[model samples]
Target: METAQYDITWTTPMCIMTLRYIGLVMDVYDGQKPKDKVKPEMMKTAIPNPPGFLEIAAYGYFFAGTFVGPQFSLSRFRSFVNGEYLENGEVRQSSIMVSIRRFVAGVVYCVFNQWGAVWIPDSFFNSQEFFNLPFVWKIIWNTLWFRATMYRYAMAWCITVCLFLINILWLILACF
Candidate 1:
């Protein structure tokens, strides 16, 4: 548990770096100015701050969920990403259904995350003022942060799923 708290605590910086790298690559990929000329501000939207994790989390729906969906078993995320899935060049009803399901899954996760967030508050840390605190308070600040992190993770995961579905829905409509 201690390790998990530490691991999640740093996702903010990592996600930011990832967005920066991708935005740079994408600008070059799209025939825009070279990465050297790209301003950091322009690409920062892809990776958001910790408190703003929800915004960036939604991208998972597109880049990861749409490209490589959850259930993590389905190869949709990988196959579509690799170009192999489009080899035959066909978009069917089945694909659209998968997209919807991803968003639905995200909705479920969002519900759980919201509920958990309400049940726990930063007040739990107020106990730190007492002269002799329980051993549980050893890392109360860390605990509060951990709960917040879990809530954020859930939001990110769900939003990403929903985003993927939205993208797929758009593609399916475009095909027709």
Candidate 2:
């Protein structure tokens, strides 16, 4: 992975190696290579000296993406480290869909969450005078205020999920 940071040194050989690796990983995470094929640099052997630190960081970012992903393959990981991970037309089209969804979600979350005209439930803000004895209750109102705070965060999650689904749709479309 770290070794691949310098892969821009050449692109064609690297991309071919990447394509082969992606196919290999479809079976499982194989470490062994065929005797006839040309091997790219081994990322695991990278020496993290002063110059290699940035490359190491780059490697970490790629793996970070895998944390949220369902599939895992050593060969695929290695290929991605090289330049085989090319962007495609489906990705561009799905970006348009996601852009629209994101805009709608953002507007609903930011603006609709605040829309109100006399929504007072009466009990929401007022403390019952009957129960005068209590320990340190919140300095602020607990009922509506707390629920209202949580609503904004929930809305944000919905918007993020919309974006995530957009990307997933992009991948599915790419498969065809």
Candidate 3:
């Protein structure tokens, strides 16, 4: 029998959601206990009242974080939704220049990763030429190869963060 191969696109979002749900459950459990029994750090995130289904859904599907997350607690989500960060319900304008800078950085990272892949292809590792190299040179090649691979992830994360910042700016603008 042959094993079937599949492309699973939901894995990343599912993993992130799973962690978030687990954290919420643990926080709720902690909240049910006496204050003295909970660690101070845990208490900071503890939820005295579990959120309703709609709130949980909103948190799970939070637009800025649903795809590639810098995962945060439900409390933080609530604070954001409630506009707790705003002073006297006033929305502060985000600096356009800052967002522009972040967008430029993300583009730079993406371009660098593209060039890195072309220059230091992963296929080089499997080639006979790689094995024929001196030990020190092999190490150098491996290091460069690793860095090239990691740049792809770096580019993605940088772009995602830039998007998240833009989303926040828009939300603030819309709310005002």
**Cα error, candidate 1, residue 150 (Å):** 1.6
Write the candidate numbers in order of decreasing TM-score.
3, 1, 2
Clashes of each: 4, 1, 0
Provide the lDDT at 11 for model 2: 49
lDDT (10s digit) by residue, model 1, range 96-154: 56656766766766666556556554454555553266667656745765665475566
State the lDDT at 74 in candidate 2: 43
lDDT per prediction? Answer: 0.51, 0.45, 0.79
- Against the true structure, what is each candidate's TM-score? 0.43, 0.30, 0.79
Report the error of model 3 at residue 9, Å. Answer: 4.4
Q: State which candidate, 1 or 2, has the greater TM-score.
A: 1
Local lDDT at 171 for model 2: 62
lDDT (10s digit) by residue, model 2, range 83-112: 376575223435556657765776676554
Query: Candidate 1's C-alpha lDDT?
Result: 0.51
Higher-scoring candidate on lDDT, 2 or 3: 3
Where's the lowest-lDDT run of ten residues in candidate 1?
Answer: 68-77
